[model samples]
Target: MDAALFAKSLLLGLAIAAPLGPIGALCINRTLERGILAGLAGGLGTALADGVYASLAAIGFAAFSDALARIDMPLRLLGGAFMLWLGVREMRPAPPRAPAPVRPRDLLGTTASTFLLTITNPMTILAFAALFAGLGLAATSSNADAALVVAGVFTGSMLWWCCLSGGVALARHRLPPAFARWVARLSGAILIAFGLAALLTALA
Candidate 1:
């Protein structure tokens, strides 16, 4: 096993995911409002998306990359529409309710939503392509190494999510309901803006 390659890939995943983008904001908001399970589920979806692109790059799947690029505009539009809808829905003030056990459907929906967002972002694949090439991993890696690298990327990305959700869970108590509501509003607005930008870019 190429342990060094695995470690590098893992770190790369962590580094990529650590940035507080729209997805990060969503995860944090979910953690504060819905609980750790919701946040982790959302985060896992993003990890899977990252794994898909990283795997394609590491294994040099040029055909799939080209195909994705071909349909990028449509994908962006769909993702943007979904994001706008979600943002508007979330912008409403959350009603205070007792914390209940997480439902399977909720987790599934949350994960699927984030997955769609991540996969539709054209920049994600390009980022992986550039990173894999710069790290000399795109052309030189074997299938086995590629598989390992992909696995590492997923694991590392999930690890970051776990940490983020856990940390937020710990501080979940400190945030008052009013403050949480404000956070939700801000996060929702951010997501809406990002969605609008993506839509405009696609239309352009």
Candidate 2:
């Protein structure tokens, strides 16, 4: 159908997901700590959420999106609390030893954790709405066109994660245990600060 429109939406998705925010930090941390698969799991979760938001925007679900926004404060609070907990868990001391086996549950856990983290920010929908409107793909787009664009969004987001995780996995062997530990703690501190800021904003 509209290949140009689909390509634009794909780029939009890449731009949205490219930011090195909390999710990016988490993915990198997991990649370094575990392996490439673990990192990709985290990315997959966020990508799925992006797809969900993009789908809503493509379908022009204005009313439903607005309804989610109404509880934005609560969602932020929940997300902040979870981040704090996750940061604390990451900071927990671990013996310098061999890496543990990557279980199916661990991948699922990473996926679930990132998914929860991404979806809590209802602002993502607003972002998609604004972006889609700007691109003239929200209300005016045909169902077929919207579907293609949404698929492109998912592909673009997933591609970013794959690249990030792959890079981190390659570097994992170069990092010493002590350095990895420091990175973990530093990431924890950053996450804690982010959590506090979000919590304070919610209270305000």
Candidate 3:
């Protein structure tokens, strides 16, 4: 793998993952509710999902790609519905105390949930495919290069999650219960909006 190519991939991956979207919001919420480890696990899950999609794109599996494309809209609809449900759940009233402290099981659950959510988005795969094709990444023709690209993606994702979690944590104490509730509601609303937009695009 060329050093320049690896650096380029790393930068591009970071650029793509830095956006604060549904996943980022979820990571921040988890970090505040649980801890930094929980958020990191969630970020790792998303990064792994991205790597999987990238690998698939690098291999140029046409049949699988076409199948994913065919079902992308349905998948997007399902994702949107799930996000809406999550938003509604977040908007509900809660008790006046923090929930249980973070545990190993909590970490595992958080990681798995985020991983499943990220991986099930067929649009992500298509996005990776288009990016790989546009960047001529497949021309590298080396598993090591592919691995490096995956590492870059993982690093970039982790960086974003860490920054978000840290930033949220910094202000967590200052925010009262009421403020936290509003924050949750606002984040949930944004997530729902993104989901709706994605659904509309898929339908169109």
Candidate 4:
């Protein structure tokens, strides 16, 4: 694997994944409610999904990419709806009762949910396909090179998630319980707004 190519791929993957979309929002919420490790687990799940798509693109799976492009709108609509639902669920008033303790199982659940959510969005695959083609990366026939590209993608994604989760966690202590609750509400609202924007863009 060429070092320059690997670096380029890693940078591109990080740029694409750094956006604070629904998955990021969920990760942040989990980190705030549970801990940074839980959020990192969720981010790893997303990175795995991205690597899968990157592999598909690197292999020049034109049929698969074409199929994803064909159904892109519907997929975006579904994703947008799901994001909206998640935002609303997050924003709901917390009961006066004490919050439940974070469990190991909860980390696994968060990871699985984000992984499934990301995998179902075929647009991600198409985006990868286009990006690989544009960068002349689709012509890579060597398995080693392909593996390196995939690894780069995973590294880039993990870096973004780590930064995001860490940044959020750092601010966790500065705020009181009331402020934290308000932050949660604001985050939920921002997620909903992004969902609406995505839905509108798709419809348009």
lDDT of each: 0.81, 0.78, 0.69, 0.73
Model 3 local distance difference test score? 0.69
TM-score: which candidate is best?
Answer: 1
- Could you arrange the candidates by lDDT from highest to lowest? 1, 2, 4, 3
lDDT (Cα, tens digit) per residue for candidate 4, span 86-126: 67877874632223566878778887877876775544555
- Cα RMSD (Å) between model 4 and the true structure? 3.0
- Give one digit per residue, the lDDT tens place, for model 2 in 1-204: 778877887887887678776778788888877778899999999899888877777776666467666877998798789878877877863655545678999999999999997887544545666776677666534779778878888888899999999987787777787866776777777677767877888899
Residue 109 in model 4: shift from native, Å? 1.2
Query: What is the per-residue lDDT of model 3 for residues 62-167, given as tens digits with 9 covering 90 to 100?
Result: 6546767787888888777767776676566354455356788878887887777677654455566666656666665677877776676667666777777777
lDDT of 1 by residue, 1-204 (tens): 888888888887887688787788889888877899999999999999989878777766576567777988997798788778878977985775545688999999989988988887655655666666566566544788888889888988899999999998888887776766877788789779878977998999
State each candidate's clash count: 0, 0, 0, 0
Judged by lDDT, which candidate is best? 1
Residue 190 shift from truth in candidate 2, angstroms = 2.5
Candidate 3: clashing residue pairs, number:
0
**TM-scores for every predicted model:** 0.91, 0.88, 0.82, 0.81
What's model 4's lDDT at 17? 73
TM-score of 4: 0.81
Which stretches of candidate 4 lie above 4 Å from their native place? 93-101, 120-130, 197-204
